[model samples]
Target: MAGDTKERILETALALFAQSGYLGTSMHDIAKELGITKGALYKHYASKQEILDSIVERMNKMDYERAEAYEMPETEPDGFAEAYLHTPIAKIRTYSMAQFDHWTKEPFSSNFRKMLTLEQYRDPKLAQLYHDYLATGPTKYMAAIFRKLTDSDDAAMQLALEFYGPMFLLYSVYDGANEKESVAPMLCAHIDRFIAKIESGYRKPHAEGA
Candidate 1:
């Protein structure tokens, strides 16, 4: 029950944070929404910031779990691109699309992303988190995966942008979507085309030692 309460507190805090900017939402609001007293909430979370930290931790854990489940390569001493080199493009595409679905669909991840987006402008701390989670962090991760395939850092980073930019744009479209179906097909088409492009234009030659 103690563990359950802690989970509940994080979930409730995240939902409230998404709906109301993190700064706008208060401890009282989370406790009230949970139908609990402030004192009870504090028993589980000493502070709202602590609750947010737990939420971020869970989000990171889920990200790696989802990546593993999809068989996406993880960074190694050599590089993730090296790991991805032997992996199937279809599997990579599956992992990429799964991450897309996760951020846009899964309640916890979706709420966390939305909370970061909403609160980013209101707090410098959250703004950095917004960039870390949604922007620079993902770009850097993808760039690392592209590094060995490209001739230079600029080229790798550019490829990362080219690969990820479309899906990045789609998040907002999906969020505003009346039906999720409207956005899913676009994502599907994108993954297919981009995978084909990478195979023909990039990875094949690399495989041949070009």
Candidate 2:
């Protein structure tokens, strides 16, 4: 089927892009990996740029599905903001750990993250994409959620940093190790401690502790 071929092409291109940075990978490489001619590859994507665009689009689609599966609150401005404030501390822990497992376990996500990590230094576009998905974007989204939960904008941003910082560090820790099992408990413990802090007294009496 045409759709199946197109999906295969995208997967092949993404794997190649991860192994070799986008600029380092030629259309020929993808075609060769797919056991197809360059012309055949062209039928699915107009250019290498098109292939990269498709990969990004696919990543976004997968990212949303992953978030939804984790029961993450919708990031956009709808009426779902209260979900962040009221969601149980235990469920929050579950969602947080689920996300940590996903990024580390999923080949597509881990490979895409590896590609971005490698290519961001060489490409401005990739650098922006890196920030949008892994860095500032998630921070801003969390901050917005925190803002609704707390009274102060500054506190919201700080809470976002506190919440995401361990998750970020654990990614590196996960990458450096071969086994995910060892790293998971560390994340689980960290999330538990963080949430416990939030629950204990993060908010001030007026607004202070958790």
Show model 1 residue runs off by greater than 4 Å. none
Candidate 1, residues 102-140, lDDT tens digits: the string is 898898999999998998888999999999989988888
Q: Which ten residues in a row have the lowest lDDT in candidate 2?
A: 201-210
> What tens-digit string does per-residue lDDT give for candidate 2 at 52-96?
888889888987887678677775633455566556677788888
TM-scores for all candidates? 0.95, 0.88
- Evaluated at residue 81, the lDDT of candidate 2 is 50
Candidate whose lDDT is highest: 1
